[model samples]
Target: MTLVLKAMALTCLVLLLLQNAPGVGAQMYPDFKLQQPQSSVVVIKGDTLTLNCTLSGSGPVGAVKWVKGSGSDNQTVYEQKGSFPRVMRAVSAPSNDFTIRISNVSLEDAGTYYCVKFRKGIVDDVVFRKGGGTEVSVHARPSVPVVSGPSHRAVPGQSVPFTCSAKEFSPRDIKVKWLKNSTLVRAEPPHITPELSNSSYRMSSTVQVKLSEDDVRSELTCKVQHRTLAAPLRKTYALHQALRVPPSVSVVAAPSGAVEVNKTVNFTCRVQGFYPGAVTVSWLENGTVMNAGSSTQPTETSRGLFELNDTVTVQAGEEKSGSRFTCLVVHEDQEPISGTGILRVTAPALGENNEGLIGDSSDILLSSPGLWLGLLLDKALLAVILFFLFKRILP
Candidate 1:
């Protein structure tokens, strides 16, 4: 019995040695070979992707399958018995070619793919061979950027927010920038989000801008950069659309000092340094609104501000003396601003008696001072002559 046991042990050791030998193990499956021709591939999003897997020599192959990833994280891609909606065999059945085509490929499809061969076993399938992995890189171009600004219009020195956004892109790394009038502007870091359904990415960037009068013609641009883009994408927003500048108003009379009765005088209303050009100007005589006036269109200045001139003619009548002419300017739905000028009227010259009343009242008072002094001297001289005559007669 001991000798029989020894012989059995020797037989088992010899079998183990043969199994462990390299050439001997290779001889068991010398004719089996699985090949994956492609080393790597890149596919754009929403397009089709093809992975080639061909078998040259086969021995005890029971099934062929494609898998993504490795070990614990691996997931089956293509299997003979399973149904995959977006996956299909590239070639017809009854062939050694195992190439597959994936339709509507997305970022989630990007990974290492492997072609594997399984051998039928008593209870479970055994991995027979595996091909070198084919690394798949999916690339998708970002959508055109959209820019938005604050809802309410901004005045000078007011800070407002602007946002830029792009969506449905791949390869998470992206760059965004803000520019004002072709010059770079500092902004906050972009926010990136992932799409769970399509495995895509979305990004948004924001910037705060302080408005100025110079921004009337300025442009704000949002620029995006990505590896898939040949050139950076740009979207511009006109700064004038978000800016408001109140107008500076003033009223000036043509005959500044005073005018003769019945003389025609002009009062000009000047509206300057306003943005967006549109404005309403009206004149007021005393406290009542005037209907007669000529207003010019608002014209842009070299500095990008706007200016307008409105003129009204009035006769310097006796009843209209000391009347106040006011210019009321309304801009951008804001409260009206006003500037005023006073009208002074004088009677016409009527010989020497009305010579003092021909000009302004202040000027008449200044010119009559010398005449008053002369009259006082004449009276004194007459009194002195009479006194001397009386003294000689009394003596």
Candidate 2:
């Protein structure tokens, strides 16, 4: 009877202890619960972040704190003693709300966060409960794109290189493209590199273009696309900035072939297929600079090149016969290009009674031998008749 009573008392003490223990009481009451409503969150850089947490039930409770990461990599984010500068409790103390707010969040702040319940023990605080972690994903927008081209001017049929670059962006997923005059241009694949300084990424894209005369007014665009951008970013560069095409020069006379003396002649200088429309034209006579000629404004061609025409008028005089007329074209700080035309002059004919008549008779006699012999025979016959008449008259 004594052994039986001792065993029963020991079993009663064990039951009392189990009912008062925190972990056992939590399971027995079934009212203790912790909840993290958000399983994951995404926030942009420089924006505020909110981590939701709630506690309920009338079970044993203790101080609450927010912890980031897990295991050996864990770090205390917020607690009753102290917290980081950018981190704080969302609700005031003495309440069931254990939500947290982080202001001015950066890329470094991205991680999983947990709302933890801790109980004060004899030696140290012990973890009583933990809510499901909230995964934080921070995103950073890429910088504006910058476009560049070759330093020297490019000509038709030449290949030139152009570059477009962007930096300081998070997440390696990015796209870059090139365009000319709103049309897509084939280019090399984008080169992505890690920026160790800020733990971000940078990208560059290059394209090789075979130039044509039509590119003088063309525009090149660099377009960038990323997950953080609502619309693609674009930067434009004018092709004319690096294009240079020389003009083809020619000189033509109004009459074409040859012109008589004292005749009015028109000399035209044609400047075609040149870029950067600004040009000057001058005329020269026998290596001497003549008066400024009339020039038409540079006109744009179908191929986007420029053309101009300049005219100079002069009288063709006897002294100006065999004279040379030159057309000089100066375009875009380049040396002069020249084209030349020659003038031919002839004197007016004289009347029949003048020295011109005597020269014509001599030419006819020299050219017709049969006619000269007939005239000589007629003269000899007339002389013989005169001699016979003189002899008869004298006898």
Cα lDDT, all candidates = 0.89, 0.86
Residue-wise lDDT of candidate 1 within 1-395, one digit each (tens)?
A: 99999999999888756654545534778887788989999999889999999887756647999999999799999988889999999988878899999999888889999999876654576667789999999989899999999998999999999999999888899999999987899998899999677867999999999999888989999999999888999999999989999999988889888999999999999999998889988888888989968999899899889999999999999999999999999898899999998999998776835554466766765667887788789999999999999999995
Give the least accurate 10-residue stretch of model 1, judged by summed lDDT: 17-26
The root-mean-square deviation over C-alpha atoms between each candidate and the true structure, in angstroms, is 10.9, 8.9
Model 2 residue 102 CA deviation (Å) reads 3.6
The Cα error of candidate 2 at residue 183, in Å, is 5.0
Off by over 4 Å in 1: 1-29, 37-42, 59-63, 67-85, 88-95, 118-128, 135-139, 193-198, 351-395
Rate residue 147 of model 2 by lDDT: 90
Which of the numbered candidates is closest to the native, going by highest lDDT? 1
Candidate 2 ranges beyond 4 A from true positions: 1-30, 37-39, 59-63, 69-95, 101-104, 118-127, 181-184, 286-291, 317-319, 334-336, 349-395
Q: Which of the numbered candidates is closest to the native, going by highest TM-score?
A: 2
lDDT of 2 by residue, 1-395 (tens): 99999999999788756655667756864777889988999888888999998889864556888999988789999887864898877889878898888999888988999998775554566666788899999887889999999998887899999999999888888999899988999997899999987768999999988888888889999999999899999999899887888899999989876676677988999999999888888899999999988889999998888999999998988899888999988877788988898887776656623764565677878888999999999999999999999999996
